[model samples]
Target: MFCPKCKSEYIEGYTHCKKCDVDLVDELPEEPDEYEDAPSIDPVKIRYAPNAIDAEMAMDLLRQNNIPCFSKHSESGGYMSIYMGFSVYGEDIYVDRNNAQAALDVLNDWDIVQGALGEDPDELEEPDSPEAPDEPDESYDNAPSYTRRRTAARVFAVYFAASIILASLFGALIMLLDILLD
Candidate 1:
């Protein structure tokens, strides 16, 4: 059987997918992914928000401005973000390469406008209570980078080249030894 959600195959005894908790099917799907037009998920971090709420606001801003953005947030205590003001691992917002420059321009303009108004977004919470200052919300949009995947093809290429060089060196060493002995 196969899990339709994850497209993972399972043996006859399994009737459901453990992770998805969905009923398995006798035959796997042959259809391609429905989100074919969606940009590839190789995300580059654009901005780091002080909290999930801010991160959400950033997402909303990007979406409203017609930029496709995503948030990388810690799953642990995610629900508590409403009550808790901060996250252990700060939230990072990402945008695809296509929309990065435009997204950065929007964020930078927001920063400049806020500075001109002498208003900190965090201070809007309450006048009586002030929290520790957070690191400036830095935007990495100009970098436009992704985490490189170490593929089997790359590993095989390195191993093949090393083995060829080793074999050639060993043969030369043996030939040199034979000549010296003679």
Candidate 2:
């Protein structure tokens, strides 16, 4: 047979080009299905629907109030779908079926719901306490005040000056003694 690309004579029944190394036979394969379906799974139930920060705060408050609670998706690997292609689930709080109502009551009583919702609840009003007016005492006004001692720099300078004076005095005494002995 003759190679169509190079025009070179090849032996009969040759499957590839001898010069260009091109496959004489077609090498295309069948296309795969793109719309393959996946098996369906069951949806999870929500025991509590606290928002992300509120849920975490509720969980901590529940634990502090002695009601055992945990995040939902963290316990069961199930996520909550909020919108189309947008889902949030990890931070939602959850408790056992028995303690769910009690947890809600504790959160309500502590004003945590309003705090988590970014609003001040009616129960958060400050209590008025009766006390004497705050004023400065007059006894300490005439008392002698103590000041901080000198820093290391000033002490070092004084010591350095004293040492120089002492050294000069000793040197002058030694020179007088040498002159008298001479």
TM-scores, each model vs. reference = 0.42, 0.28
Over 4 Å off, model 1: 1-33, 74-86, 120-182
lDDT string for model 2 (1-182, tens) is 55556666666678789578866543334447755565333322223442356556666777888977666543222422332122232344555656656765775566755666776665352211112232433754654342111232345447778999999999999999999999
- RMSD (CA, angstroms), candidate 1: 17.2
RMSD in Å for model 2? 24.8
Query: Best candidate per lDDT, number?
Result: 1
In model 2, the runs with Cα more than 4 Å from the true position are 1-50, 74-91, 112-182
**Which has the greatest TM-score?**
1
Candidate 2 clashes: the total is: 0
**What is the C-alpha lDDT profile of model 1 across 32-106, one tens digit per residue?**
888987657555667767567777877898898998888876444353344344554457778876777788777
Model 2: per-residue Cα lDDT at residue 127: 15
Per-model lDDT:
0.67, 0.52
